[model samples]
Target: MLRITPRILAVACIASGLITAACASYAPTPSSDLAGTSWAVQSIDGQPTSARSPSVEFAAEDRISGAGGCNSFSGVYEAANGAISVRALGRTEMACEGGVMLQEDAFFAVLDGAERYARQQDRLVITADDGRALVLAPL
Candidate 1:
């Protein structure tokens, strides 16, 4: 049977280099900074929510994957210039406690309405048309 061990997990993290805290300071436009990076959700709607470790990674072929605090998700995305769009977004339906599932719902809602994105140092700010926003830092 396939199993995940702590050592394997650590190795995977190191190999993916998804930790944003230790990354070098890279200042750039949102598109370039976001095209090929994994970002961790720091806040939603301007306030930090008790969502478990949530993150998003933008990949080539218009693909994306990450956690929504409660469950892992993967889907397609389209980002160009400073505009961003997330389509076909899908996530696991696992039930979670502590309002994590609610946070996930809110997070996806913001993403669905996402209109613009900006890069502030290592942070990626995605704002919706309704002024809602998701603050993410390089993961």
Candidate 2:
């Protein structure tokens, strides 16, 4: 047999209410402004790197178009709420010497394996499942 007490019932109700409120607060909110806009790479892991602050533009057709330093690149983008992914990227080959080429190569390599995206204030962050993150800001 089980007995119900007022104190126990009150605690249970309070716990349930707190859990519900926590879940609601943590839920991600989708931003329509993020779509169909251009953004520029700002900093990586809080370090300043101007190697190539390329711009990315999202399209209504689920595509992402951007300039990879000296070359142009395009890819497919899929996003929902707080999650975003880019796939099947293709880029033009243009000769760029010095640090620009190196930066472009690094940037493209990161994008090729990008698995998730997050927005923080005015910055957009792309990340891999391994925890590596890249930050970008509005252009």
Q: How close is candidate 1 to the true structure, as a TM-score?
A: 0.72
RMSD to truth, every model: 16.4, 11.3
Across residues 2-81, which tens digit of lDDT does each residue of candidate 2 receive? 77899989999999999998878553343334667788876544545575676788776677889877889998877776
User: Candidate 1, which segments miss by more than 4 Å at Cα?
Assistant: 1-33
Model 2: lDDT to the true structure = 0.75
State each model's CA lDDT, in order.
0.82, 0.75
Worst 10 residues of 2 by lDDT: 25-34
Residue 100 Cα positional deviation in candidate 2, in Å, after optimal superposition: 0.7
What TM-score, over all chains together, does every model reach? 0.72, 0.68
lDDT of 1 at 96: 84
Collision pairs in model 2 = none
Highest-scoring model, lDDT? 1
lDDT per residue (tens digit) for residues 31-89 in model 1? 44466788888999987966385788997667888988877888887787888888888
Candidate 2 accuracy as TM-score: 0.68
lDDT of 1: 0.82
